[model samples]
Target: MARVHAPRLIPDPCSSAAPRRPLGNDDAAAALGPHPGWARLPLVVLATMATVIASQSVISGAFSAARQAERLGYLPHMTVRHTGQHEEGQIYIPSVNWALFIGVLVLLVVFRSSERLAIAYGLGVTGTFLLTTTLFLVYAHIKLRWPLWRLIALGTVLYVVEGLFFAANTVKLFHGGWLPLAIAGIMGASMLTWRKGRRIVMAYQSDVEGPLTDFIRRARNGHLNEVPGTAVYLHPNTVPTPLALSENARFNRVIHEKVFIVRTVPANVPHVAPQDTVTVDRTGADSDHITQLTLHYGFLDDPDVPAGPRIARDHGVDIDPDTARYFVSELTLLDAGRYRGMRKPFTLLFMAMSHNAAVPADYYRLPRERTVMIGAQLEL
Candidate 1:
């Protein structure tokens, strides 16, 4: 309200001058010259504190969003630490924190001053604003059931304003504005590549491995060497049996007495209750030895492959969690330049990422001694 009425509320000395001079720093200091030290010092401190608070909020928001993205399969998983037991949202990601710290330090060193940094800052802020507006427009139309005319009208108004702001920022493209665009472009490309690469890999695996029901039936009829104790296989698709299981039976010529197929699906919710997280479905009534376990995890929930047996036990499926052996499919991509659609550079990048991704044993919380990785080479 003070700012809205400032022109009328504050006395304007320029009103008395025939040709008014622009207000300078000296004029502002002169205006504040009457304030005592106590008042001035506190005001300056308050402004600094407010700036710090705002920056902290933005930093925290970025961390939270990154973690959520990891859960939704948009990014790789990083270590997450809960800062407070009572506060579920109070979490810290060490990697993101350090990256942000280093990025800010580099920015400060390069820009040297806030005036120079403002050119880059506006691009980041306005770019994010436009993206959020675009996403929300779709969300409102589809999820919120907004009318078509209302959507078009609101979208046009917002796009015009934000478009102009973005265009204005483009004027500073060579003057540090390119930094945010470059960063955004790289990150966006990497994420899209990862998503596409994963889908392609899954599709390839599905083609290689047939349906789970058929595999189970064949194994039962073949009278494969039955090994003692339960064995759990983590599969990408619930319908298709993992190559790991087929490979184990083919090469090793042995199968566990009780085979559990565990497939995890990430839910849209934040956190699913532990009790309702696992749902067990038997592969067939005739085949009591094999069961299909579907694990539903929230975007924030950790997927524990080792927990499948325990969850099965709780639900009256006969199995011991401690003695179960976990089999995980480890793909070795052979880049023969056979893949299409995804560029070769991105395919190579995705391959590098897959090689560096967290090992299934550690990620799934499986016992190091008991967990076995079945490797298969696939040409791409």
Candidate 2:
């Protein structure tokens, strides 16, 4: 008798259509149940309060004094450092922790005007709260298929909770809470700028890289081009612009005609289970000569998961391996003071430690030597 191992069943990768099913109450109910009256309503409200207030208090009252004192004209000492969580035992700054207690205590006794900052503070905080709640409502209505009344009840509570966070944060602001508000404003602006920057950078990237077809042509004509029955490319979730797309086409000199960009989504809480996969929507004109596939997976999914070529093989789509190559772009980050924070070395180190760990490129069976890494310099 011969020992045998059963081959695993991989999903069909190149299919444009997803598995569809009729809307049944059971599935809808199960989905709706997650956002029950308590979870979405009361429980979320409680968690929100605990999160916002506690965060503000810790940031301001706790370490706030040490940071402010070191900056100001008193006994100046204690340099601010981003230690990068070297100490396994300690979670945060201890000296600052105790100092905040003292500072808040002293503020309570001396500063009678801690209320004025509340108004300025409340605007940003409250607005975010409202926006987040509204987004939740929209998500619930659109995705979960919750009843309108139930959605209202859930959203109303969330809205009210966000309202309270704003209200309370506002009160703190007017009472000499400018720092927190200022910090929030700076953070909000920074986030917006970062998002915009990603767009600009992506646009520039696609442009510099040129279109896949052009790159493929160039590769075919030059060094980058090689024997290729297929090639899979991985991309970040940050969307690409048309300019970048055109550029990518031009730079590549030619395109794989067959490519895949798999992205990993971040999860709020860690849980391992039936990991969902998303197909990346491809742009540019479609030709049987080339096929671009996008896959979306989350952290909960094992990073070493196989995709595309594997799927094609499992699904019986024709693809030749010895000729196929996997292409991955490496993003190198440098800490530039242009963003107004931390040294570049530290940021780069952090990034290095956290490279693509979830999945190795060769997991799909293209082999390491066959893979190509294009170094991409990220905009600081």
Leading candidate by TM-score: 1
Candidate 1, superposed: residue stretches over 4 Å from native = 1-55, 334-341
lDDT of 1 by residue, 299-334 (tens): 666687667567768878788888888889888888
Point out where model 2 deviates above 4 Å: 1-169, 174-183, 215-231, 236-290, 298-305, 319-325, 331-371, 376-380
Whole-model lDDT values for every prediction: 0.82, 0.50
- How far off is model 2, as Cα RMSD? 27.7
Per the 3 Å backbone cut-off, how many clashing residue pairs does candidate 1 have?
Answer: 0
Q: Write the per-residue lDDT of candidate 2 for residues 319-340, one digit (tens) a residue.
A: 5545666666655555455432
Worst 10 residues of 2 by lDDT: 70-79
Model 1 steric clash pairs: none
TM-score of each: 0.80, 0.40
